[model samples]
Target: MTRISRILDADSYKASHFLQYPPGTEFVSSYIESRGGAFAQSLFFGLQIYLKDVLTQPITRADIDEAEEMLLAHGEPFNRAGWDHVLNAHGGHMPVRIEAVREGSVLPTGNALVQIVNTDPRVPWIVSYLETALLRAVWYPTTVATRSWHLKKIIDAAWSETSDAPQERLVFALHDFGARGASSSESASIGGLAHLVNFRGTDTLAALATARRVYHEPMAGFSIPAAEHSTITSWGREREADAYANMLRNFGGPGKVVAVVSDSYDVYRATAEIWGESLASQVRAMGGTLVVRPDSGDPRTTPVEIVGILAEKFGVRTNSKGFRVLPDCVRVIQGDGVDEDSIAAILDNLRAKGFAADNIAFGMGGALLQKLDRDTLKFAMKTNAIRVDGEWIDVFKQPIDDPGKASKKGRLALVLRDGAPRTIRAEERHEGEENLLGEVFVDGRLTRDERLEDIRRRSWR
Candidate 1:
């Protein structure tokens, strides 16, 4: 989390020690669930790197002792045995197996994206205990990844209607501005990389570090030299013309693109007078596009109006699709109030204004990362089946109040049905059924190392 909050955060916090789940329970099969209908697909599991950054500290004897000591200090209840198995190889070598769809795969609602089980008798409550930390790992990134994925589909659809290179532009269309807006640096890193699973443009530098350290992608994301309001307004709001000239002088050049925030003072005047009339010829001659950012005004109206303003000053070319696109030297970025709905609204507005989707891009902050929670898809991990004594018993919940809260039953396997994914009880599986959920994490080792590139490729598929 943050400086002070890090002291209060740990993986052990998410561990469940309910009376229903006792130490004698030999086998506990807990599966991740996404209730049903959601804003995006119910869940897109970003389970790969959760342990890497989110729940970083693993259990140790000293940690256990310290937690017990703190419990003593606070006169609160504590379970030392809960941390014992993880500290003592609770599941041992043949510990639990975690099966899930691929890291970047889009999972539809009402299926278990992740099914975890600690099969060893030594650690009965390991999976349930790990739930505290592990569920947060899956849900947070999954929510962000699914949200970004849905937004990309929307952005791609809009571009496809008006732009020739829809695929090429869609990936670079949305940039991450959520680093400062996030609750913590780690939140930024996790959610930023989740967004990158669908897009390349980002300003969250911490995500690059996470990709390098956890996912093993040293150069995972890319960003252009961009300016904020402080950089422009610092040159004196009265001297707005000089500020725009300075942007072109320093950051603007052939094959070198830079986005300048123009809403600091008189955005319309800056666009019409400074950018268009004064610097338009220099921008055309000096090479690469000058991406103007209108950081204020209605997202539905701002982008279209800016496109019209830029087109008048810099000139526009009619693409074969019959919509006007900005010349190679100029473009627009509608950053303020950019979210999924506003993104759709702005694109539809621009197309109505006879401008190609290629004329503008977007940047999002808090909405891209911190705005989500575990309940965004009603994510939960519940005991599906357990072995109390020697016999394996099928366990489930069928609450009459809310059927949505009902849990799955029996040993589960993620199998593909005619090329699409669905969960199956292993007992009822056909002879040649292909289970898509592979063992990514086992015991204390990451058995499967999914490259970000492979995940990206699969996401497109």
Candidate 2:
């Protein structure tokens, strides 16, 4: 991968922002908020990753020269004097202080998640100058984490109502299938790690390494041996049974779990006959589980029907919740056409059919990673306060056309009021109140390093 200079990782217009700010501007304070969108709350994540990956790399003279040449060629003004001042004065480290809620903290959308301000009096523009990259770094994974967290909530509700072992099964209900669908390897790694905040099952292999390297977790997620369409279909149509048997022989064992895609020829026949009859005894004797995957069908109804078919073929038992569940040896997974609505609808359909939620799990791909955008959560970073000529001034945007586009004002502090987080003026914080936003980064250094374990624990709503 080419290592583009982080200095150039901004909007072309950002190159000229240093000169646009008012003269004598000494400090600029900004905050990031979701401002209400798809969800009422969001799972805060990925800031530490950005601080460690991007901000920690000191800007070199070479980076400055490269950026200057590129920006000039692109017809944008380059702040060579500011770049040289940062390089010579502060050794190329961004002169900024960043305070954020602890990674993995779940908070309401309208509250502040991160606060940024220029530490040096000379470069107030640096606060907003970092917005383009900084906001991108925070929003993507945070939105992904929020999506995963809410999915957990949906599953948790269904499992609580219909499963005997909701707590045990909840961890593996939603598996990450977004690696190939992700825009890039880096995206797969981060988005995959975000899903791990709420679940333990994932197929995104890069997320494991990301967890180990970024959050100091040796292993953040797990996956069983699973078969895709290519591996199962390569046996030819007549030998479909051979493909299923091969998965059982190679991956199935005592107390092991193996998933096989059974929708290549006909999902109904494959589940009701091949897996339910020819290999029924083998599956029962394997002392493990066979996860039957149906890849192409109605997202809301197909899984429910397959679960009913499996229960008849393999037999069913009524759990303590009074919901029918398949034998431990056989289950179903729906990997296609899955999203928040489809997942909930499927669970609702399963409950309506008297099947336990544990009869099936979900494998979410593009919808989990690539389909969302910054506006999914309505995330935005706006300057809330600035210091001019050593006097503090509150700043905000109030558009008459869209009141929802309004931004917060004044230096802010996120504090707990009656056990709930409230964004309030920093000066209005009462004595003895603890601000949730702690200084996480300062002068190009990470002040607080968060671990994945703690982050996952904090994410549990």
Candidate 3:
């Protein structure tokens, strides 16, 4: 049994969720009743198989009855004749053998990792409707999850030096713009959450909420103080200063303020002069620290200079335990256009200037998520080859020499080989197969219901 099954008993599992259906039952029935024929027979067979597990449950009966009553009361026309015929059709008439590796496994592009076999010759037409969407739903999440895992490695490495300070070390924040109606918002949200197991910083509110609900990230990316007032007039209002003050007044201090973006007008002058005294004093007085953010210009020079100024003028006072006051006094966050190389440079510069590594937070946006070369990550699907016209023709994309879009074909099995998981193609038919995709739902019931935390833990692993 999968980990998902251990928590929920068998009976409780199957009564919750519904699986995807091709063309959907309502459409299928309408088409068949309005224009009755062999197409109707196919629709009938599909619905029966689709609802086999559903009709067995009392809950489903109640729902169906309720829906029927509503429809009848409203005089809504539904083809009950076509619906009942399809509902009562032969269960084994159209068999679609779907074979896929476990959903979380990493896959390559143009690979026939998933195979859908239409047992009945007449059901081939339905493949076009389901194939594309199904493949994408599975493939993109896995890809994003894999990418997030890779990012975890980088963050883990960078934060290693501050192991003594567990809270200070290893912060993971994700800003998934892909959720704002991106072509693959669902994939992006799932994939983004899979990788954001550590730290907290993101603009995607829904993704953040999901991550917290499912993953339990400590700090949330609430609001970043912007210097909007700096550009209010021709001279631009000292928006950065005003914004910081407003935040301080409302939030009571910078304890909850993770980071503040200060460079809306002039980064250098702002760091040295503007709000430096007043803001820093407020944060320090309140027993909180200010994280000054520079969203533009050369980070290599900006953070180094800002840290230097804060330390020089702030009086290097030691606490009761004798830790340097300035190092913990404030932190510098660099955002705009930051990449791995640029981040590395900023870190190196800070270290050389006696700035604590943990005192610098990297606010990575497009560079971390969007700028990655899609070519580096391979994701694809393929259909299983079946006997056609008495010829053993392999229906698969031939492997390409290109590293980015290589394809793996044939009826494959993913097994743990030599203690590490690997994929193996089945040479011939075998009985009692261990299907990677199990019956998540049976008879209109959910076989497994997992908490968001559980899913996040699985993704982290």
Question: Highest TM-score, which number?
Answer: 2
| CA shift of 449, model 2, Å | 0.5
lDDT of 2 by residue, 1-461 (tens): 89888778888888888888788899999999998999999999998888998898889999999999999999999988988899999999999999999999999889999999999998888888899989999999999999999999999999989998748668899999999999999999999999999999999999999899889999899999999889988999999999999999999989999999999889999999999999999999999999999999898999899998898899999999899989999989998999999999999999998998988999999999899999999999999999999899999999999999899999999999988899999999999999898999999899999999999888884
* Model 2, position 218: C-alpha lDDT score: 98
lDDT of 3 by residue, 105-207 (tens): 3333233334454434333332333333444444344444454554544445544532233643444333333344334444345445544433345555655
Best by lDDT: 2
TM-score of every prediction relative to native:
0.93, 0.99, 0.62
**lDDT accuracy of residue 320 in candidate 1:** 86
In order of lDDT, best first, we have 2, 1, 3
The residue pairs in collision within model 2 are none
The clash count of every prediction, one per candidate, is: 3, 0, 17
lDDT of 2: 0.93
lDDT of 1 by residue, 74-165 (tens): 65556665556555764223256777777877777777888888857766666776676668888898888888888888888878899875
Clashes of 2: 0
For residue 445, what is the lDDT in candidate 3?
Answer: 40
Query: Please, what's the RMSD in Å of model 2?
Result: 0.9
Candidate with better lDDT, 2 vs 3: 2
